[model samples]
Structure formats: C-alpha cells, structure tokens
Target: MNQTHLATLLAVLEEGSFDAAADVLGISPSAVSQRIKALESDIGRVLVRRSSPVVATESGEVLAQAARRMALLQAETDVALRRTIARVPLSIAINADSLATWFQPVFSEVAKWDNATLRLRIEDESRSMMLLRRGDCLGAITTEATAVQGCEVRHLGVLRYRAMASPALRDAYTDRTGTIDWAHMPTLRYGPNDKLQTNDLDGRLEGKPVNRRVSEIPSSEAFLEAARRGLGWALVAELQGRELVESGDLVLLDDIVSDVHLYWQYWRLESTMLHDLTAAVVTAAAEALD
Candidate 1:
C-alpha cells in the first residue's frame, strides 16, 4: 500500500543486496534498512530474507510485483499524457536457444518503444521462470506450460533438440549394425544443471538408466566444439546445430530427439508495452519453431 517503501523493497530484491539497492536509490544503506523495516511493520510481516544477497520472502514478492506493475502503468500514463519519461527499464528472462535464434524481433519491437530499455537475463528454460517469480524479470521464455501465479502463459512453439556427435565419433562408435554403446561413451553436458542428456537417456534406455554423468561444458558454442572434438554426444538445439548437421560435421545420432515446448510467461499487468512486446516475441518464435 505504501508505494515508496514498496519501491524500496523491489530495489533490494532486484539489486540482490541492501548496499546495492542503496547505490541505485542514491540513499544511504541505513536509510534503505529503515524503509524496509518500516514497510515490514506496516505490512505486519517479514519482507526480506536477511542473506548476503537479500531475497524476498514469499509475500515480499507479491508486494514487489505490485510495485513493478504500478511503475509500468505509470510509465504508460506518462507517455499517454504527452509527458517525457526517461528510459523505462524492463528486464526479461530468456533461454539460450531462443536468444540465439528468434530474438531479432524482440530487438526490433523494443526499439519501437522509444522510452523502453531492455535488460536480458539468460537462464535455462526450465529455470528462467524462477527469475520471473522473484520479480527479477517481468517476462520469461520458459519450458513451462502452466503459468506462475499472477502471470499469463502462452504456448509459443516447440524447440527441437537432437542427439548429435561428430562424424568421426559416430564412425568409430556406431558399428555396421548401427548400434552404439551409449553408456560407456563420454557425454557432454551444458552444466551440472543441465539434464537434457539424462532425460534423453532415460527415455531411450528403459530400466537400466546409464547413470552416466560426464562433462560440464556450459557454453553452448563450446558444447558444440566439444562434440566436434569427439568429447561426447550431446543434445543440441536444432537451431544451433542444423548447419553442422547438414554439413556432415555433426552426425545426428539417432531418431531419438527432445522437443521442448516453450511458453512465454509475463506479468498479467495491463501494460501496453508488455502486450506489444509479447506479441512481437511470439510472432518471431513462430517463424523459427515448429
């Protein structure tokens, strides 16, 4: 209910610490603390989790979103009233594949909004929703069909991932019978957080999952490089590897593939900018995804 204090809380959660929030607000750290304390007293609830990098308690997130939504609405009003609004900063979360493939339209759309400036955070599609839920981002491209509460989810398109390896690896590994021992081979992983290979393996090998965990090369480009150098087979996004596959550099391992259906989730706030940007992003994705 208190807009000023609510904005303070949003800043702390966004900046990830009280001192950082103070730097953004041009206020003393003690002042930031006093505002948060006053806000907690007024709301009768603990708002921030006092960690090295501060985090919002569950109710704190709701208040933070409320403040963000109000800011968006205010910006829209200012524009409509023929008033000058400096850059309106909007943060959105996106996965790597989408960023690499269909993001040109997002740039075009944002550029049309003279006052809207964009900051992008990259996370795995499975995890990007967490950033949106925390108010770190207002929208997300994610692999979730169900919307996070207070956000609207739209099915954009399916991003197809293929199990691939270098031609040399496949030649040495796949026999005349086209059979390969997947369990014993080295595997490439995007990161410890990545489970695409595990998910693919689990789907392929019925009872005995290989329990195969290998490399943790998180860079998408480097993952392809490792695959090219025969480090291991990997599930690469179709967009990222289609050229290599066509050029006979990366061999398509098998018919087995992973098609992750991506969804666009955004705050349900009635902001014209969000609506326009969402439409632009979804339209662009349709051009690339199935």
Candidate 2:
C-alpha cells in the first residue's frame, strides 16, 4: 500500500524472517507482522507463506519488483527536486579484502571530489553483487565478471598476493632443498572463505599432510600483522605487504603467488556524480594495484 508497508514486506521476504527484517528495519517483530498482514490484505493474496523461515510467493515476487522500482524512482525524484544535479551520494558495496588493501587509496582519491559523498558497504567479494540487486548500493567492487541487471562492469585491475612469513619463521621452516613441510608449521588464515593461502598450500602438498593449524584472523591488516609477528604464514596482498617485506619484517614464501582480478560494477543510471567517483577509483586502483 504505502512505501513503508512495501519496504517492510520486501525486507521480510529478502531477510527470510519477520524478526530479521524487524532488526534491519529498526522496528518490532509485531510491527513487521502487522505491516505484512496489511499488505497481504491489500493485495488479496497470501504473498508470503508463514513457516520457520518466510518465503515470498509468486505474487510476492511481483510486488517486490514493483517496490524496488518505486524506491529507485523516489530516489531520482528527490535528487531532481533538491536541485542537486551532480551531488547525489555514491553508494558502493566492496569486499573486505580489497577494502583492506588497495581500496582505501581509491577512497582517498574520490574524497578529493567535493560534489559527492561516498557511502560504502563492505562484504565478501562473492556477495557484493547481492547488495546491488537489492538496491542497497549503487556500485560494487566485485570479483564477478557478469554484471548484475541494470548495471555495467569495468575491469579495474588485478590484486596480487604473495605467500609470506616472517624472516625468522621462514628460515626455521624452509630446508636446503627449498621444500617446506607446511604440515608441521602453523598458518595464519583469513576467515573460512579465504582461499588465497589454503588453495596454494593444498596444491603444494598434493594429497600429503598439510598444516591445518590455522589462526583465524578476520581483519586484513591483522592477518598481515599476525604473519609479521611470526604467528604463522599467510597470503598478503602485494600492496599491503611490500613495505613490510622491504623492511625485513616479512618474507615472501619462495615464488608462490595468488592474483585476484577485480572489477568495478555500478548501476547504468546517468549520474555524473557516480561517473566522477568511478573514474577516481579506477585511477587510484591503477596506481596502487596491478
């Protein structure tokens, strides 16, 4: 019915539960239930099936699409009425790994532009595209090659990471034949989804015993710091780890390297502010990341 009701229903469907939707919408579960009931009554259909986790019916999908369009239109209308032609906030969703490495330089470059504000949502690279589809963000730094609906993509550059350890640690573990048995050594890992170090180790071990003794360091900077402190070896981004490597704090683990290709994806709307921010990000990425 109203925008608020439509938004509440959409949130409930996306979040898959009334309680989760209420938490996101900053309202009570009872309020969310009432709004959804009102919406279902207005539509004259059971838009959502009530279960352990809510699911949108076919009718709910139609309403959800309409709700998304309405929200986008309202945003454009507000921008037009404010007479702020090129000053709209540029909302971006980016992965944490990039944010921890080269993305901050990109932000620094964009911040120099005075006309627009930057809003960032940090999630995993694999999940950033979902934020774009849900109208949660205007752009995303995604690993995805295929663009989301209503968005365009550009290849920014590749971020290269090197397997690294502390000099003392590397010397202690590596042998004369250059064959380091990781199974006997501790490892510093990013969260469970982090494949940079583990994948390489898996290949090197080749069905042999490899160290699964991992310390879960979620923050990128912390992950590198853990390696530097000789807590364990990790894959550190070239940009973030280069200075430490040069300072003799960290040592690259022989020739093992991982390169992650990154792309910038943004809505294809005709917004000059978004264009400026994109250009700035691309420029910075080119400089900071290969």
Candidate 3:
C-alpha cells in the first residue's frame, strides 16, 4: 500500500531471500516477512512463495515492475525539486574488482555533493549490466559495449588483468624454461559466473581447459586471498594485484594479459540527479581506470 511495502517486495525479489532483502532495506527479517504478509492480505493474493530461496509470484512481478517505475518517477520529481528536496541517494551497480580498486574514490570525490548518497550493488562485470536492464540500479559499470534497452553507453576505460600465481605455485607448475601449460595448473575463480580468467586462458591457450583443478571463491577479496595462499593461480586485475606482486605474494605467470574495456550504462531518463551522478562517476573513472 505504501512505498515502504512496495520497496520491501522489490528488495525481496531482487535479493532472493528475506534475510538478504532485510539487510538491503535495513530492516529485520521479521519486519520484511510481516510486510509481505500484509501486502498479500491486502491484495488477497500471495505475492511471494515462502521457500529456501524466495521467488516472486506472478502478481508480485507485476507489482515489482510498478514499484520500479514509481521509484524512478519519484527520483525524477526529487531532482526537479532539488532546491526543496534533500539530496537523493543514487543506486548503482558495479563489478567487485572495480569496487575494491577504483570505484571507492568516485564515492569520495562525489561526497562533495551536499545531498548525494550512493547505494552500490556489487556484481560481476558480465552481469552488472543486467541490473540496469532490470531496473535494480540506475547505472552500471559493465564490460559489454551494447547498451541495455532504455539506456545509453559511454566508454569508461579498460581494466587490464595479468595471469598471476604465488611464487611457490608458479615454481611447482612452471618448467625451468619459464614455459607453462595452463591446463596443468590449478586455477582460482571469482565465481561460477566469472569467465574473466577462463576467457583470458582461452585466448592464450587456444580453447584448452584451464586446469580443471579449479577452486571457486566468489568474493573478489577472497579470490585474491586464495591465490595469495597458493590455493591456485588466478587472473587478477593489475590495479588490485600489484601490491601483492611487489610483496612477492603473487608472481606473473606469463606476459599474457587480458584487457576488458568497460562502459558506463544508464537509463536515458531526463533527471538532473542522475545526470550529475553520471558525470561524477565518469570523471572518477577517467582518473582511476586506465
């Protein structure tokens, strides 16, 4: 009935769990469950299936779409009345590596805006654009050049990655000639959806399986940490892994590098707040990303 309830429903659908949604909305799981129950009672229809991983019902999908539109419109209205309304928080999506490395400075730079706040959703670069397409975020830092529907794209910069491993791991896998066969080495992956490392290996090794002995660690920091501990070799962003390399925690496996060209994509809506936020992000990216 109210925006709070609608927002709660949207968060549950986006996060796929009551607890996760509650965390995002800064409410307790009980409060989120209560909101869903009340919403169902008012609508006379179950909006979500109560299960291990919550799923939105058909009715819930419709309402979720409505809520997204309403939220966007509300943002627009706030921007139009910027002098009257307090500064608005901008919701954004970005990859974990970028967030860990270059993205935080953008938020610091933008802190100069009297009324702006940033709500960040950290996803993989391959999937971040999907967040923008689904209305979960106003803008995204993504690897894809193609713009999502209703959005425009701007080239932010390229993120370069180097094949890296701990010295011990490298010594175990590499021959005296410094020649290495990737298929023989164990690999550390960012997540199930991550193909950055695999794709890099593909380009270098001609479609060979990347050391089937793979360890899947989902978090950016965790993945690097795993690599540092010699769990497996990993492809790491140059910016993120540089200090480790200098400290001898990681060694470059080969000169082979992967460069992912990143783009900023956002809805083509006419909103001053969105515009200002986009400018700040782009400026920051230019300074941070090579």
For model 3, what is the alpha-carbon lDDT of residue 140? Answer: 90
Candidate 1, 114-231: lDDT as tens digits: 7888989978888898888877788999988899988999999888998998988777766688798776667787776676667776666665756674887867778888998889
Q: Number of clashes in every candidate structure?
A: 0, 1, 0
**What ranges in model 1 sit over 4 Å off?**
82-84, 209-213
Q: What is the lDDT of residue 102 in candidate 1?
A: 69
Question: Which residue pairs collide in model 2, if any?
Answer: 183-211
Tens-place lDDT digits, model 3, residues 1-33: 878888899889878899999999898999999
Q: Which candidate is the best by lDDT?
A: 1
Best by TM-score: 1
Residue pairs with backbone atoms closer than 3 Å in model 3 (clashes): none
Provide C-alpha RMSD values for all models, in order. Answer: 2.1, 4.2, 4.1
Q: Lowest lDDT 10-mer window, candidate 3?
A: 80-89
Worst window of 10 by summed lDDT in candidate 2: 82-91
| Model 2 backbone overlap count | 1
